[model samples]
Target: MLIRYTPGRTGLAEGLRRAARAVLYLPTACRLARDPGYPWLNAGAVRWLDRHLAPAMVGFEWGAGRSTLFFAARVARLTTIEHKEKWRRRVAHLLARRGVGNVTLRFVPPSDDPGRPGLRPALWRELGYEPHKPEFAAYADVILDIAEASLDFVCIDGRARVACSLNSLPLLRPGGFLVLDNSEWEKYAPIFTAAAGWPRLDFENGVWRTTILRRPGGANG
Candidate 1:
């Protein structure tokens, strides 16, 4: 069964109730260790992952940036795939400045036509993230080429999210995690169901919806 994030904020009283609950119940320590200057995953997801992602594990992400640094600190090695040269270069500089040397970044060009079904929808303005299509398909291929079951974690938070999600499923090691950010979009409903074999945890923290799906077995802590 799929767990959905539907917060019903009917009025001020109801909103305040949630706010009060958050102050009392939410775990503040699970937030990302540091602010990386961009939107990352939600707090609950961060907390869960921080507790579970051990330093010996290896990780990968479809798009790189603040997340590159974020995961690098937790995992032993991290590889990032990016389709934009400009973004890749900028992220590389930040990584260098921060002295994060364990990450490998590969810049793959957008190979597919920009127009395609399930490719682009008008979710950019509302969700602040857009799916990169044909180019994304190419990027997904690079991730698929990674040795099967070799990565301990994979994050499909960048463009071509769906394609990356499909490819990432097999690349993860048993008990590994596949994290998809901005998962509340209606268009991504299929992804949740398709990931049937894994244990899925959905988190909604007012600002973003993040889904952490695990491959079979216990999470590597």
Candidate 2:
């Protein structure tokens, strides 16, 4: 025989207490969750960082938005690149609002037009970054068509699958890290093939494929 018990006063009170705690914590959790910066990175990338590159000098995020803000807070220095003026301003404002001072946001102009070869010169100049300093810049069709080759960690959450992979390769140090989002895209298959020799971890769940590539050397790599 079984006894079916409904909530009596104490049970009801306990349930109410749990509900109250959830409600009380809801706003804070929501605030953190909705923060304009720091939306979750790919799980594999996060794990790789925790294991390998968390203590590295600095990191460059190729498409400045929420992720850039998040990474800036965690790293020693964060250089974020966005091509659109509007997004650049938004990222700047968000960083300021979040009291994040280590982030340097750059608005990279289009270089696809042969006439605009020097379009990004002013941005680098304004930032006082030497031509040799490691920097990441985004383009509509490419994550980083041009950047320094001494990058510690490169996050590719932008466009131009093949171009991004090619441009990102040189940026990594011997034991650096590279992460690419939307790896499930069929067009990026060749890029994966190119990276076959590197140590890689991948996760695909129908909608997205996140691939984390470690440069060939060192503990994390």
Against the hidden reference, what TM-scores do the models get?
A: 0.73, 0.64
How far in Å is the alpha carbon of 199 misplaced in model 1? Answer: 0.9
lDDT of 2 by residue, 95-196 (tens): 888788887787766553322224333323433433211222234223344465477777777544454565566567767777788676666665666556
Candidate 1 residue-wise lDDT, 58-176, digit = tens? 99897887778878888899999888899999999998988989999989877764433343222332344445465555676676457778889998877767767766776778889
Q: Give the Å shift of residue 216 in candidate 1.
A: 1.6
lDDT at 150 for candidate 1?
Answer: 87
**Candidate 2 clash total?**
0
Cα RMSDs of all predictions?
7.6, 13.3
lDDT, residue 13, candidate 2: 63
Clashing pairs in 2: none
| Model 2 accuracy (lDDT, Cα) | 0.60
